[model samples]
Target: MKQLLILGCLFISLGLIGQSEEETEIKNTINSFFSSFHAQDSVGMTSVVSKNVVLQTIGANKQRQQVLRQENFNDLIHAITSIPDSIKFEEKLLDYSIQVDGPMANAWTPYEFWLNNTFSHCGVNSFQLFKQEGQWKIIYLIDTRRREGCANQP
Candidate 1:
């Protein structure tokens, strides 16, 4: 009975370790994508996404009607790269909520967008990922952006 108890504890510890590792890897994958974004490196951003990844944004149109804007990955990359060097922007991500099941996971990140060190908007990002070939790759991404109803903090 004593040996069995010890083995049981060992297995539990190993399971916890596995979970910790998975969380770390998931966060790392997300961080890598942002790092690439801040650097304006299209290739780096593309490296972490699956070929068929979907991108969308939630925003209000000119008529104030809410709409989902689906974006092409390449077009986004082009836009980012085209930004003038004189301007600087960043999406500061706050907390991350993650869940995993087998080979898929989802992460929710609340963020503030800053332009030239001034807060422009705040929103949340939802990222869906798939474990492919032993690595996590982003499969879908959607985010909300709002100027009002946001606690803009530096």
Candidate 2:
């Protein structure tokens, strides 16, 4: 009985280790994407993203009505690259919750967007990734943006 219990525990430990490793890899992939985004490096950003990736956003319009917007990947790249050197922006990730099942994984990240050293908005980003040819690549990304419920908001 003791030997059987030990063997079972060993297998469980191995499985947990594998899961932890996968989670770390997924987090790294997302981090790489954000690093490229902050640098405005389109090439670097594309390296970790699938060619057919989808992007979307949920936010409020001028009248405070909620709206969903779908963005073309190429257009997003162009917009990022077109930013002037005088402007600075960042998405500060507050927390990450990731789950993996086989070749698919989802990462939920809450973040605060800052522009030119001022708080702009806060939201949560949902990133879906796939393990393609042994490498994790982002397949879909969506986020919510709101001026309320921000940590630093007055």
Candidate 3:
């Protein structure tokens, strides 16, 4: 009985170690997504996301009415690379909180957007990812943005 209990604990410990490694990989995937975004490389960005990925933004309009907006992924990608040379943009991520279960993972990141190196907005990005064919890819992403309470990460 003692030996059986010990073996069971050993297996549980190994499983947990593997789970943490998966969490790390998921986080790396998200980080890579941001890296590609900052570079304005649409192809690079697409590599980290699913083909049917859904993107949405939650924010308020000029009248202070809340709005939930969904965007076309491919159009957004095209728009990113088509931005005129006059403006520069960067979305700085503050921190990440990741959770994983089996083949699914969720990453929550707080971020601040800068346009031409000037503060623009701040929000939290929630990414739902799946381990498809042994690699993590973002499938759904929703974020909240507000003009106030932005963090000074510098």
Candidate 4:
């Protein structure tokens, strides 16, 4: 009976190890995407995302009404890569909350957006990913944007 308990514990440990590895892979994929974003490397960004990826944002319009805006993937890539060399911007991720089930995963990241070293806004990004051919690829991404209730604002 003692041996059986030890064996069961071993199996449980192995399962947790596998899950941890998968989580690491998922985090790496996200980090790679952001690295490419900061570098303005379109190809690198595309490599980690599905061809049919969808992007959206939750924000207020000019009249202060909440809206959900869908963005074209190609257009977004163009906008990011078209930034002038003199302009500086970054999305500083504060934390990550990731969950996985089989081949599907979701990552929630809270972030602060900075432009030219000044605070621009704060938000949370939710990413949906699928495992394709043994690699995680982002399938959908949506984020909220707001200027209030952010920590560390000056």
Candidate 5:
């Protein structure tokens, strides 16, 4: 009985450890998404996202647009490259919640983007990630952004 209990505890501990590692990897994947954007690394960004990825942006002008497929990817690459390298945008992942079931995961991360040290916007990024061949890749992303009023604090 004691041996059985020990084995059970070991199994539980291993499961917890595995979960912890997965969480860390997820966070890294999220971080990589932003880092790629900041660096204007099109290839790097594309590698993490799904081939049929969808991106939607809500601009300050109140215009909502959707980007799909290769055209979307090209547009993003162009937009990022157009930005002057001096105009640094720093993204902070303030909070994230993830749900995993089998080979699929969904994550929501509340984030703040800073441009030249000033808070530019805040939003919650929703991501649908799938485990493909033992790797996690973002299948869809829909992020909504709103300007930060003075009343808001990051």
Candidate 6:
């Protein structure tokens, strides 16, 4: 009976380890997605997104309403690449909660983007990720954008 108890404890420990590994993998995948954006690595970013990925950016501009697809990925890549390296877009993850179910997962990452070390905008990014063929990929993303202040609007 003692041997059986030991075996059961060992099995439980292995199961917990496996769960921790899976969580780490998912977190890494999400981090990679953000890293690609910061590096302006268009190809790398594209690789993490699904072909049918839906991207939405909400702000005061109409141009932000367009849906992004694989066909226009290059254009988006070029746009990001055009930003001067001196001007940085940093996303600080304030809080994030992720849930995984079978092949689907959803994550909410509250972030603040800084420009040249100054807080420029802040928003929350909602992501829809899918584990397809054993790899996690972002299938959809919607982010809200707001300037620091608008009281002085013209």
Top model number, lDDT? 2
TM-score of predicted structure 6: 0.74
Whole-structure CA lDDT of model 4? 0.95
Residue-by-residue lDDT tens digits, candidate 2, 21-110 = 999999999999999999999999999999999999999999999999999999999999999999999999999899999999999999
TM-score of the candidate numbered 4? 0.97
Clashing pairs for model 6 are none
Looking at candidate 6, what is the lDDT of residue 121? 76
Query: How high is the CA lDDT of each candidate model?
Result: 0.93, 0.96, 0.91, 0.95, 0.78, 0.76
Model 5: colliding residue pairs = none
TM-score of candidate 5 on Cα atoms, chains taken together: 0.81
Q: Which ten residues in a row have the lowest lDDT in candidate 6?
A: 64-73
> For model 4, what is the error of residue 23's alpha carbon versus the real structure, in angstroms, after optimal superposition?
0.8
Tens-digit per-residue lDDT, 64-118, candidate 1: 9889999999999999988999999999999999888878999999999999989
Which residue pairs overlap in candidate 3's backbone? none
Candidates 4 and 6: which is better by lDDT? 4
Segments of candidate 1 deviating more than 4 angstroms: none
Q: How far is candidate 2 from the true structure (C-alpha RMSD, Å)?
A: 0.7
Pick out the ten consecutive residues of candidate 1 with the lowest summed lDDT. 145-154
Per-residue error at 90 for model 1, in Å? 0.7
Residues 1-154, candidate 5: write the lDDT tens digits: 9999999999999988887777767777878888898898888888898888777664455353433222376688788878987788787888889877767888899888888998888888888888898888988787767775422556
State the lDDT at 100 in candidate 3.
90
